[model samples]
Target: MKLQNATVLVTGANRGIGLALVRALLGAGVQKVYATARDRNSLEAVTALDSARVIPLQVDVTNHDLVSRLSEQAPDVNLLINNAGVLSFGNILEVPVEKIHEQFDVNFYGALNMARAFVPAIEKNGGGAIVNILTLVALASMPGLATYNASKAAAWSMTQSLRASVSDKNIAVYGVFPGAVDTDMLAGVDMAKTSPADIAKAVLHGIETDLEDIFPDPMSTQLYAAWRQDHKAVEKQFAGM
Candidate 1:
């Protein structure tokens, strides 16, 4: 679906790539952007963009009841961007099990809840798009961030299933993978990172063209190419990173 004049709702809109997506959507001629975060106070920057178009909403995607309420609250929503994520760095053997659940709660289950809650609304509005901000790590495991990688991989698989389920509903599902984005999620990582703004722009472009899987950064594109050629080779390469 075209983003122009579309009503879009973005989760985790307080900072990082989510904030950048709100900005990019505005430039794309979107009619409204419901910028949601767990803490609405953190949405000051987003609300400052365009008071009329930027609607700050306080929402925790992990809350199933609250997410279900979105179908009634924002009935006009057509595009849903699942961008909220968490990263607790530790190897699978060393990381606290609760930490793994925490990451999955937001990264995987949260996205699933949002998708379920908004599907009816999106269908009502004549089917639009769902963009899941997954990671390149979804395709491979990084030893230090084993839990995060696992959570994102689950989300990646979920996105694929959602796409298949929604095939006849006219709703387009997009899975975005970017390697090492310059966001708080990668605070301590010392590697070449893509700007959130650039990733956001690329995502919008992908949506415009109805690209099913979007590789929004150079690293992601290269890694995807390698994976396509030899998945195991790329997996081994990332395991060492």
Candidate 2:
């Protein structure tokens, strides 16, 4: 489907990549974009855009009831971007149960819940697409971010499963594996990170080309290439670090 004249809904649109996506879609000439966040008031940036084009909707994808309700309410949506994610740094074994649970709920299952809730709506709108934002660390475990890695890994698995499940329905599911991005989520982490605008532009380009999986930046592309060619080497590299 073309980005132009499309009605889109992006979760966690108040900040970070989600906010960038709303702007990117607008720049792509989309008809309307529902920029959703946990709190609509926090989306002043999105609202500052053309109010007629960018609609600020309150959405917490982890809330199943709200997800289903939004799906019903916005049955005409053509694109769904599941960008809502939480990162709780620590090993799964050492992190508090609550933190681990929060990570899983917001990072992994949150995307899944949104997909499940919106599949019918997307199909009803004539086979739109779903994009699940992931991370390169999902391909290889990282020490300091073990819990975050685990959550994204689970999301990667879910993305693969959903891709197959939704293919027949004409609902394209794109898994986006991006490395460190310059966003609040990666604040203070010392790593070469890509700009959110670059990633957002790459994602839109991928969607336009009908790419199923998108590596939105050089860092993600490099890591994904290594993982595909020498998974063990990359694993050992992270393991050693």
Best by lDDT: 1
TM-score per prediction, in order, is 0.98, 0.97
Expressed as tens digits, the lDDT of each residue in 1-241 for candidate 1 is 7999999999999999999999999999999999999998999989999999998888898998778776577889999999999999988899998999999999999999999998888888899999999999899898889999999999999999999998888899999999889999888788899999999999999999989999999999999999999999998897787
TM-score of 2: 0.97
How many steric overlaps does candidate 1 have? Answer: 0
Cα deviation at 184, candidate 2, in Å, is 0.7
| Least accurate 10 contiguous residues by lDDT in model 2 | 88-97
Which candidate's TM-score is highest? 1
Query: Which parts of model 1 have CA positions greater than 4 angstroms off?
Result: none
In model 2, the runs with Cα more than 4 Å from the true position are: none
lDDT of 2 by residue, 74-115 (tens): 778989999999888776578888888898999898999999
User: Residue 102's C-alpha lDDT in candidate 2?
Assistant: 91
The Cα local distance difference test for each model comes to 0.93, 0.89
